[model samples]
Target: MSHFESCWNPASPQALQRRAALLERIAALRALEDRAAAASARSQAVFDKRGQLLPRQRVALLLDPGRPWLPLATLAGYGQDTPELARSVPGGGMIAGIGWVSGVRCMVVASDSGIEAGAIQPMGLEKILRAQEIALQNKLPFLHLVESAGANLMRYRVEGFVHGGSLFRNLARLSAAGVPVITVQHGSGTAGGAYMPGLSDVVIMVRGRSRAFLAGPPLLQAATGEIATEEELGGAEMHTQVSGLGEHLAEDDREALALAREVVAQLGWAPPEAPPAFAEPRYPADDLLGLMSDDLRQPVDMRELMLRLVDGSELLQFKPLYGAATVCAQARIEGRPVGLISNNGPIDVAGANKATHFIQWMCQLGHPLIYLQNTTGFMVGKDSEQGGMIKHGSKMIQAVSNATVPQITLQCGASFGAGNYGMCGRGYAPRFLFSWPNARTAVMGGEQAARTMQIVAEAALARKGLAPDPVRAQAQFEQTVALFESQADAFHTSGLLLDDGVIDPRDSRAVLAQCLALCADAEARRLRPLSFGVARM
Candidate 1:
């Protein structure tokens, strides 16, 4: 490893402008996250009367103090709930992340029950399912904080109802795969929501607050003509003592969370293995804010950003001068050996071929691959076509698809076309994928997409021996541009579950370090598979 000298000038005008731009975007991102918290906080008086801890408070209590929590899909359902951005509450009404609880790294999925009484929102289902997917893939224990009003009937999508079954199925699958599924029912978990606790390997329910029944009084009475109080039906005590459902019962929210943590502590799960010796990056992580520009076309040195990520800012360049656009290197993050592939510009033929070889090499070396994506996509047009862009690009994609290594993608800027595939975008199923606030992703940029549509329309008109209607063509182009621009923004992509979550650029190093460490631990840990899942007594 060679020491990488820093060339990033933070005092430059461009850096100042980039810093200001990044701060504004980060502020906006924080505000959206704050909105979800504020929405949950609004129910505080009600929760206070009920003597309950808020969802966020419960999560805080459940995690080990001072440990990092990587919140996923914070901007989920951003524009979906309403057209007005100000009125939208992101995070799909859920708070989920990878956090440490009782020394075990687990996927903690807490229902944002403070919002809309924790009614299941459209994208909230997707958020939890994605969390389950992460736990399953990484072999992490599944911990669910259950206190939902179940699916929102008023705004229910039948598709959501049809697909929600997978959540329970995943619980069983996780348990069968030797990954424990733990649940703490802080409040109502009626209807399909009951399954979250029922399927878990460990269940801790609050005595008064927890209620996990397939149907509440109204539905129960309407369906079976049976009159019963929620307590008698599925209260914590009743379930624990009579129904053989809940294994442990607690007095309130705090006790329930404590029990959940205690349960995690007793799991005897393997801890993260010791990482290799490493030094901090040479560059200041705070400089990360100024290093990235909002404009994708503007050339930004990805090497400068990578310099701030790897240990001691040391990176051994794989192919420095050749295929310069695509940057590949061997480096250590948080003392974990990994190979990095980044782009300073669009991936051309040589860059694609270089990346292909680097990915395969990383796999052979048994190292994980980290992709710092900031490309407008593969180079196009006549010269590129003659240079075998398609074939070479395919080689990169093939390597990305079958590398047999843990690949993590960070959408730092533009991620478009086959460039996204080559860079290990969401479609390629990287071990984990995340984005920065200013990240932009689409099949192509708005202008390019609009232009392409216009050209196609004009060519079609010419084929019909007709002249293109300029006014109609211009109107269509504007709409296409607007649509693509809005949808490609990080908020939209994150809401659609395109990336794991949008993160603050300043926290990239810490986040990457944690994730890389987790990937390493997962690779080394072994699990005892069983013929059947561990069932509750």
Candidate 2:
């Protein structure tokens, strides 16, 4: 493989400015994540008094130290919890990630119970479901640090309650798929929540703290006029010894986590060996921070970014001359062969055709595809339309949608309109989707959307023999811009779970390598499927 030469000047004024802007955005993303942590930390005093470890602490103890942990959906319920963006704590009231437990890759989910008594927020349900989906797809063991206060009765919606059934259904599906579902009941699991432990293949409960019951004392008293202590109802001892619900019992959170780790270690699951030695990228990964301007409108060479990502900065260009705007290349990320498709600008007819063919070729070669999305979408114009843009664009989207190989997407800049679909955006169910803080995803730019609406509205007025009101027109335009600008921001979209997570530009190589490694692992692992989930019996 040939090494790529550098054209990036880190000391240049433009580069420095871009780096500064990216750092500011990264800081803001980190601050939002810290807010979720701080919100959970506030309950330390309460947890201390009860002699129980916090939710995060339990997760830390359960996972193997120094191993890579890819946190997913950190912005899951960002602004959904409340209208106030600043006050809204994201993460869907849960901490979840794919990490190693006893050398076995596992999906780790811990309810952020410290917040609102670990109530099941609307997005939290979605977050857990997504986690289960990933675990099942990758054939990873599912380990949950559960201690939810169940659904928030005050803010309950009938739809949320109805959709929540899927959570239990997924657990059963995971088990039936031969993916072990292990639950460490750190706290209350009342009513519908009892199924969490009930459906798991392994249940580890804390003697004093873990409580899993179909009905708690208050409900039991209200309905049956017969009350029992929490211990008698469904405590760890009762579930483990008498009810046969829990298989392992522990005195406190620490031991419970230890037992959970031991269970994973004993599962006899091991990831394939690491790849052979590989050369690092020639360019400094930190330079990625300045590779693209903060503004998506600015054109930057996507090749520069790819050079900093692939091994030894080596890339074999595929059909480079035919579609200059669309770059297709063969590269290796951490020694794992991958095909890369990126956009330097809008994908025109030729670009779309090139990408379509490249995708099929990659699938034939059994190489995972990496999409570096940075397009305003497909090119549009009278001439371009005549050039079969739609026909070609559809072919690209079809290849992306049906590709047998795992596809990972990193939204480096603008991902708008049909380009998102063609490039395997979140909707395509990419094996993993991540975005840089500067990335902007929307149907189109705010101004373009507003102008289109204005033109349509003006045409309607003209048909009615009316004139457009300047004042109303201006007001509508501003409102439309504000709406798109707010939602299209990477932070806002990430918070809404539009992407897996927003990452630092400098970490692109590491992040991509990790994702590629995971894809490789998934391909290598084998599972024994069952018609039915392992029941508690």
Candidate 3:
């Protein structure tokens, strides 16, 4: 194995400036995330009065202590709740991520009921659906901490109501696939939300607080002059004893969480194998914060970044001379073998062909692929165009699309043009996709986009035999740049759910290891399937 030597200097003025900018970006991401949590935590007094734990508190109590919890979609619906980005809170009124529960790795989703009674926010429905999909894909037990006012009828959209049915359908699918769908009804599940527990394979409800009803007193009284208490309609005791919807009943929030943990423990899941002993990377992971400048246009040695990520800082470079701009290497991350592909510059014809071949070879070897995306795009010029850039680029894309092994992507910097698709961007559905705080994703850089449009405008004016208005054209150029640049920000795209989440650069290795382990476990595990999900009859 060839050990990678680092020439990175952390004390350089340029490096210090880069690190400071990256740190600020990470801090901005954290501040938005903190705002979401604060929004939920504001209702703590109410929760305390009701003898209940906060949504996060409930999640912490249910998860195994000291185990890693990878939070997903922390910026799910930022600015979607309202037009103003600063005032809008993210997280979509939900908390979702992967965590270990009673030694069983499971997908955990909880309704942030503290926020507007946990009414499904703009992207809240999509968030839960994504969680359910991940659980199903990974063969993970689906665990839900339920307490929601269901859809926000006051702000309802026709499309949202239509898409919401998938949530219940996924619950049925999870149970049918033999991946347990477990729900703990902590407070309220009204109207269509009642099916959350109804479709689950196992349900634990808190006695006095939990409620699941098709229609509450007002709706029932309005439709059919019926007078009945909440308990008579769909209280936890009623569901457990009479309706047969709830299997286990707890008196309080803590008891419900304990019951959920105990149920997970009883699932007969085998303990995960202990990881093989491995050496840590030789380079300091902290160097990652300063290694790459904030500007995606500036060139940096991607090999240096890879050295800090892979185990023992060893990499066997593949086809080093053929397409040096596109780096492909064989290495291990946390003892798990991975094929790393990253860009040092725009992919020329040779680089594209190299990547296509490397992708196919890795698939054949059954080693997972990790893409460090930082490319302007495939080389574009007369000579390169004539050299079959399209053909080779397409081949690379096709290979990425059909690769059998799990592919994980990290948008370390620029992800632009077709390069995003060629590198297995979120569109191709990598096993998991994440972004560093400095990552910028767009069709092309703002300057490039603005210049392209300006040239096109000039050509059009020339065709009309008209002179261009320089002042007006300059104004248009600046506006176009601003529009593209603003949307390309990592926080903006992440909030729109373009990627899984924005992560700190320092945490990339740990995050990648956890994701790789998930993929490996999913491959090794076996499941039993049935035609239909278990019904609550």
Best lDDT among the predictions, by candidate number: 3
lDDT values of the candidates? 0.90, 0.91, 0.92
Better of 1 and 3 by lDDT: 3
Which runs in model 1 stand beyond 4 Å of their true positions?
A: 469-472
Q: Flag regions of model 2 displaced more than 4 Å.
A: 1-4
Provide the global lDDT of candidate 1 against the true structure.
Answer: 0.90
The stretch of ten residues in a row with the least summed lDDT in candidate 2 is 1-10
Ten contiguous residues with the weakest lDDT in model 1: 528-537
Cα lDDT tens digits, model 3, 1-537, are: 877688889889989999999999989999999998999999999999999999999999999999999999999988778989889899989999999999989999999998999998768888888889889988999999999998888998999988889999999999999899999999999999999998999999997899999999999999999999999999999999998999999999999999999999998889877668789998888899998788887899999999999999999999999989999999999889999999999999999999999999999999999999999888999999999999999999999999999999999999999989999998999988999989999999999999999999999999999999999999999999999999998888888888888999999999999999998888888889889998888
lDDT of 1 by residue, 362-421 (tens): 989999999999988999999999998889989989999999989999999899887888
The residue-by-residue lDDT of candidate 2 on 1-537, one tens digit each, is 544467779889999999999989899999999999999999999999999998888888888999888899898889888899899999999999989899998899999999999999998898888888888888889998989899999998999999999999999999999899999999999999999999999999987889999999999999999979999998999999999999999999999999998998898987577887899988888998888897788889989999999888999999878989999999998888999999998999999999999999999999999999999999999999999899989999999999999999999999999999999999999988999998989999999999999999999999999999999999999999999988898888987788888888888888888887777888888888899999996
What is candidate 2's CA lDDT for residue 511? 82
Determine which window of 10 residues in candidate 3 has minimal summed lDDT. Answer: 269-278
Candidate structures ordered by lDDT, highest first: 3, 2, 1
Runs of candidate 3 exceeding 4 Å displacement: none
